[model samples]
Target chain A: MDIKAYIDSGILELYVAGALSEKENKEVYDLMLQHPEILQEVLEIESAVIKLTSAAAQPSKTNIFSQIKEKLKFGNKEVKVVSIERTKYNWMTYTGWAAALVVGAGLLWTINQNNQLESAVTTAEIEKAYLEQQIEEAKTNLAATQNLLNVLRDREIISVPLAGQGNFATTYAKVYWDKKTNSIYLDAQGLPEAPEGKVYQVWSLTLDPLTPTSLGTIDDFNTDDNKIFAITNANESQAFGITLEPEGGSESPTMEQLYTLGVVASAP
Target chain B: MQLDTLVSQFQKKDEKAFEALYNMYSASMQGVIYNIVRDQDIAEEVMQDVFIKAWNNSASYAPEKGRFFTWILNIARNAAIDKTRSKAFKNSRKNLDAEYFVDILQTSESLEDTTDAIGIKKFVSKLAKKCIKVIELLYFKGFTQKEASEALDMPIGTIKTRNRNCIKELRTIVLE
Candidate 1:
């Protein structure tokens, strides 16, 4: 590569500006390492940026470092050196005193250990209470899951598969109807996310007259984890159907958006 | 005075080497900080914090990842930006976008005594409006190429090449 031309391309200036992506930065860093001229160019660019930026500074009012040093408590070199020596001797003296202190501390620690064990027993009891609370929560979740499973697997439930139609033929859905509970679980896993201002409406139907009844709309369609919705339905129906309606379901189904239809099979 | 050796010494808590490093970059750091904070006292305070932070985290500095100057510059920029974001700083300073770094350089009375003060003053006077916007976004405001492109309403390639030409012009004025 022509290093000068590469440098002249102005990438190194952006590199100094810290405007380059990490990958570009690493590449420039490697190239700078490989070529001295590239490195020199980067240095000059950095220097120029520095000069320009520094000119924005007001007059040197006071040395800021001295204030920082004072905050950090390293006032002078002589004082630091003297402090270092004092600390060195202080370490030896402290160690001797610490040894004696440790023996006395050991006895105190033994007494403290007994008290700590008592506290540990109390802590264990508190932990047991917390564990019990978690178990209660788990039991409630398990019960809820079991209720959902029973609703899905009940013999009274009628399973209806809704195949996609029109522009969304690839999508498929299922409905589990529990006539006893007047509840239907509409599994819309195959449907695309509803557009910003639209929603899917479920309809119950009578085949002879083509009478349609609106079951409430699927409101949390996007956020539903399994895209399975539970809706209340108590309609005497020969068939079931769905349609794409405006955000709130229409008074009647729009036949053009009739996405799926499943007729009731004759009983054996 | 190998760079690696000096850096290693500074890492090992050598105050003298740390001071040497400080002397080398302090002015540049102050400039970068001042560009962001645009207050001398606050910039100087942040500069001190940046160096102290560099000292404390000295072992984290790796030459392979970036230039030492770049690493320190990142630290200075981050600290200065953090200062600007503080409740007190934000409450006191309003309409930060009213001026750019070139305006600061052109109008600063304190920058008069510096060696390249005249050169920078002349460069700012002669700098094109486009150059000022590009440099302001890329260097002073630390905008990425894509961001600079969007801000300047130019293509990414143009931002890059224009920045290159701008810096080239600046180097001619200052480095000469």
Candidate 2:
């Protein structure tokens, strides 16, 4: 075969540009493998064309390879088992798998950590709500105590302690009477919790006649937090007493159920 | 690495070989596609898709049918043409007037990155007006001998020989 004639024929140039038919391409492919010179000519032509075309290309963006690798699901620093058939043990493969496993474990740990943190936040929220409720209760108690302190500081108000009497000697009670408001604050804290189906009754009495005025019944004795009751007392009272009654108070105090009695001091 | 070996490895999904092949022809492919697409950003996008498609369909490539460069070039041209025809693309580019690749090289200032930039710029300057049209159609546009002959209104023999001589002059200026 005349290699020189084939070289000068310009078919090699057309072949590389793919301007030839299939049969012509096959003929060229066969000639390339058979003739070293023919192959060399094709290479030279291809190389020149590559440069010429490259001259026309825009400068590519950075890291195009890594981007392509990422899209192909190939990790940057991890080994991907691209094919199961190839069993060659290489350092890169082991390192890649190890890195992948490490990343997987790291992800799992992060997720577990996040879950624990979320639960902790929820627990803190519940505890905060409980604490807020306790604070509110404290504020109410302080306000009630402050009001009681103000009543005790008033000079016109009279305090009468009704000590336990008769069979209920262990029980005692106190009343702060403010004649201006016709009201009395009964400090029933000294008394025990009222039993079921029973209420505490407050009474005002005149010393000479020993006549009693039915003030009112302490129906909410058990539910009161501080066990303090406020009663209205309009009568000129020389003494005060407390007695245990049924769900509803009787028209008069029950004598056997009488818990405490106290006399008012003479006016200064 | 030898072109044959590199191509065979690329067909077998060797990443390194694929990179080597990309480095070799991507610029040239970009040039060709840019000539058709007429937009730098779209041309680059089309080039990437062309390479990715080549990698995905590597098995379909047969040396007996064509050169690897030719195969990828064909893909790039078709993809760019397809992009141009897309409704979205057509809406943006309502008037994609006819302009040769030389117009790009002449207008572009980015030729400094290429090693043969000076030579190509010089060759393009001194290149005949007829030679420019021949290379544009026969090579950059992937026109066949017969298609080129019909398009250029020249004989098939004249198209081939004329393309051959144009390439010959290009080889002298760029290769030397």
Candidate 3:
């Protein structure tokens, strides 16, 4: 290669422009390394280009390198992993998670409280209903007792005392016959509870022929709160008796099961 | 430190080497950026951005590709040209019709204050009109031999030889 011809060819000037292809750039780089003259010429062309380009600039008042260093975080690279901004951001993240957990726990507590309150309200409503039912039952009992007192005190009513029979001597009862109402109020308070499949049958009796007329069986004897029962008796009765019979009561009194007998005091 | 050693250290992310490189080339980059954008503030902004980019992409640079100065000069020209095409830059700067980089030498009062600018001012004044256009296209604008040949309406050989003579003249005024 003619070194002077290569130098005079103006390729070195174009090399400074960075306008060459990659192959041409590699060729120029290799040539500059092998030859000292080529290297010197390239350096001169590059220096002149630098001066010419620098002439176009208006010399700025402030150096922008510091601003660039700040942008690139150049000097701060070693300390970047432990940067205060990163620490602050991590703290905020942890605080956010903690806040979320607190809020979640608060929500769970509120929900639990709400559920407990709802159940308490339900229990209170059930208790209120039970109390109200008890009040209603007491009122009904008071009214029934007051009406029974008025019936017993009436002057037109005839009272009879029934004595318990042989096997049930301790069991006693009373009958108040209200002729005006044609009804008898039987107070069987002293009577024992009727056995299953057997009911106490009341009968209106006459002593002339000892005839017994069946009234009716006491079906609700076990369930009645007060043992007082009102029964219609339109027959002209001189006496009354009670006997434990079958569930529906018999046409005639069962003599073996007679529990009580009473004679009307004002009877003819 | 030697330029090659400093550049090598810069590529390895040495902050001191980066600063050395920045101080050496920032002025030239600003000049090339100013010529394309024709505004000092925008030129400075683009110049800073160019250096920051060079730092970030330092690993991509190789001596086999080109000189470090040439590499950064290419980045500055492209960044400045991109700035001119931006909507904000176009709206702010209605007229950026400078024909050559040397035009700043004649018209700019901004350079009058700096004593360091005197030598370059003399060089630009003594530079021929043809040299100004050729250098502006080749070095400042990063135009290829074919592009510059088409732009100057001359043959590729003439552009190369003319650029050589122009750089030779520049060496006499500035480098010699």
Candidate 4:
């Protein structure tokens, strides 16, 4: 290859401009490596272009270098610090999880407390109802006892003991008459229970005239706890008699079925 | 020193070699950038960005492709052209194609401050109008031979030879 002709071809100027194709650039690079003259010529061409273009600058901007260095320094340091700070934030993440777990446990405990309070209230309510029922039963028993005490303590009451007669000789009864109040209380403690479909009726009698007046029947004779009953007496009764009758009381006493009889003693 | 060794050290994050490379080429790169952008501030800003880019991508360079000066020159020209195409540059300067680097060289007040400014002024003043357009397109604007040929309306052969002779004259005046 003729070196002078190659140098005069003007490809070297384009080579300095970086305008050559990549293959041509590589070929030129290889040639410059092989020949010192080609490399020297290329260098001279590059120098000329640099000087001409540099003339267009107003002045050399040598001061901007420090600013560029500063930017690089800040950028590198910021990246390093950001990574370190990110690692430090791991503790905050764990604390957040712990707080959530604590809140969950507190919520569960509160629910359990609510359930226990509700059951306790239910048990108290049941106990209160049972006590109320017992109070009602005691009140009934007290009223019955007071009625017995009042009958026994009356000043105008006359007590008469009726001995069992005839077929029911072993049966007995007593009558307490409160003539002022026009009431009589019959105590049939010694009497046997009447058969089914039968009741015991009381009678106020005047034995001189043999007249009988129906009092009332003992309807719940078998179930009475004290076997005592109160009946009204507006008659001028000389005696009292009891006889077995049908379920409801008869109009007059049954003489043949008289179970007990008693007479009131005058002024005694 | 070989440019490959300097670039290798630069890729290894050697700041001193990077600064050495910046000192050697930043002025020339600024001139090329200012030629297209036509503003000193914008030119300086683009020149700084170009060198930073060269440092960031230092490992991508290989000497078997071209000269290191040519590599950086290409980067400077591309950055300058990109600035001209930007919306801010176009909004501020509308008639960029009307002026060339020769006009900047002829009008520069800082020419006296440089060591070879007088020689560059004389060489640029005596440069043919065609030679100025050819070098402006080929080197400063990073145009290929065909593109420069098309822009100047000259034959490709004439563009290459004319550019060769123009650079030779420039060497005689400035590089001597």
Q: Model 4: per-residue lDDT, tens digit, A12-96?
A: 9999899899998999999999889999999888887777777777764445676667656734533232233566686677788
Task: Report the Cα lDDT for candidate 2.
Answer: 0.83
Question: Compared with the true structure, what per-residue lDDT tens digits does model 1 show for residues B1-176?
Answer: 37678788988988778777877778777877888887877887897799889888999987666667777888888899899999999999986876788877877787778679988899989899999999888777778889999988999889989988888898888888
Candidate 2 chain A: 10-residue stretch with minimal lDDT:
A78-87
| CA-lDDT, candidates in order | 0.81, 0.83, 0.86, 0.84
Give the candidate number with the greatest DockQ: 3
Task: List the lowest-lDDT window of 10 residues for candidate 3 chain A.
Answer: A75-84
Q: Please identify model 3 stretches exceeding 4 Å from their true place.
A: A76-268, B110-119
Model 3 lDDT per residue over A55-123, tens place: 677867455776777777665644233345678999999999999999999999999999999999999
Flag the better candidate by lDDT, 1 or 3.
3
Q: Can you tell me which runs of candidate 1 are displaced by over 4 Å?
A: A73-268
Question: Residue A101's C-alpha lDDT in candidate 2?
Answer: 100
TM-score of each: 0.54, 0.55, 0.55, 0.55
What's the DockQ for every one of the candidates? 0.36, 0.38, 0.49, 0.45
lDDT of 3 by residue, B10-33 (tens): 999988899888878877888888
Q: Between prediction 2 and prediction 4, which has the larger lDDT?
A: 4
Candidate 3 backbone collisions, by pair: none
lDDT for A229 in candidate 4 is 89
Q: Would candidate 1 be rated incorrect, acceptable, medium or high by CAPRI criteria?
A: acceptable
- Model 2, B45-148: lDDT tens digits are 78778888888999999888877888898898889889888988888885755788888788778996666888899899999988988888767888888888
Question: What TM-score did chain B of candidate 3 earn?
Answer: 0.90
